[model samples]
Target: PTTTQAGRAKPNILVTGTPGTGKTTTSSLLAEATQLRHINVGDLVKEKGLHDGWDEELQCHILNEDLVCDELEDMMEEGGNIVDYHGCDFFPERWFDCVVVLQTDNSILYDRLSSRGYTGSKLTNNIECEIFQVLLEEAKASYREDIVMALQSDSLDDISRNLSTLTGWVNNWILDRSS
Candidate 1:
């Protein structure tokens, strides 16, 4: 039976996008509006040491994918996790009711990432990833067609619109659960 049939229930939503996209901002806003747990996978990985070691080339931690998955299994099973991550396809599709892939203009993404001091192949690759809409394609390929949403996040207005839209969805979902 559904969690509603028993007692409490919450839906899991995945907010993913390229590094320079607004995944963190949008997800954080969404979390605040809905009062659901916002799990930043990158922070979790760092906090839990769910990684092999630092990637000297990438200038980031080398994630132990399995360990990350193991650590998140409980949250995934529990059902209220709003996961914020750069990669989305690795997550179990069933763990999410909705997968939001945020998009941004490559030029804007480039400037945003550059402001953060990203350069070389690291920066180039990310800009390219955003330009190609890789994350959106990945989400669509990995999840149910109806559940995958491609949202633009190039401006503050876009972010606010997205936050409002997602906030409404969460409200309706929770209301449905209670009913």
Candidate 2:
């Protein structure tokens, strides 16, 4: 199927959520399924030397936590891109055709964060971010309600289904936009 904005040209889809909720993984899957370029904001920041000297603490807490729209607008140009990041409030809603916010249970989130080798305060903030719905609320507040899609990633199947559903949605959006 085609996307709604296909006639206008391609559009971006942001896959966002807390760290342990599988934003990157789900975005990767959606990218592959939709044949869209995967622009991982976290990785792009590192690649562009935006965080060259920054340590993990500064990366997560300072830069990422307080991101702004100008930063995102600079990273992505007009076209279809699958942006995977933990935050979504920065980018303009007009630039994004859709957003998928992944969610997970606290126990599952804690296990995922702990297994990542994060310790002390770094881990603490992330856990709190997950528990507090920081990304979710941010997305909700930043965009129209219909533009955001929430998915719960409780297991492998959940991730797979979310990816598949997102792919289908993108396809439908494409078709609708073209027709």
Candidate 3:
């Protein structure tokens, strides 16, 4: 039987993208609108004391892919989680109903990163990552093509629309799975 919207099971969602692409913003919106638990990986790492600083220690820890996977699996076991991260390659496709990849104009991304205190090497590297479509490629390779989507997040209205579209998709996912 189909549950009422109030009793609907929230599907696991992966909101990912390159830096300055609004992954965090979109994930927050979805969590607010759908009442799902928001699991921002950055925050999780911080709370876990996984890394000490942004130096080599932190860099090495964050780059440990296996550790990230294990931690994510543990986190998702509680159910109804929105895993907000920068890429999707490490996550299992079977666990996620949808993966929304947020995208932004290169110029806008450069501006956003610049305003956020990134400069020189860091900003240039991220711009290159976005240009090369690293996150998009990761999503495509790691997830079922039909479940992965690229969305533009150039403005608040765009984010709102994306959130609505994704929420509706989650609802449909639940209905389809139950049938």
Cα lDDT of model 1 by residue, 35-92, tens digit: 8899999999999999999999989999888898889877777777799999987876
Candidate 1: 10-residue stretch with minimal lDDT: 1-10
Per residue, candidate 3 scores C-alpha lDDT tens digits across 31-84 of 888778888887777777555446652232444556667877744654578888
| Model 3 whole-model lDDT (C-alpha atoms) | 0.79
RMSD vs true structure, all candidates = 2.3, 4.2, 4.6
Q: TM-scores across all candidates?
A: 0.93, 0.84, 0.85
Query: Model 3, residue 38: displacement in angstroms?
Result: 0.7
lDDT: worst 10-residue window of model 3:
1-10
Alpha-carbon error at 141 in model 2, in Å?
Answer: 0.8
Candidate 2 ranges with C-alpha deviation above 4 Å = 1-7, 51-77
Q: Which of the two candidates, 2 or 3, achieves a greater lDDT against the reference?
A: 3
**Superposition TM-score, candidate 3 onto the true structure:** 0.85
Off by over 4 Å in 3: 1-8, 51-61
lDDT of each: 0.87, 0.76, 0.79
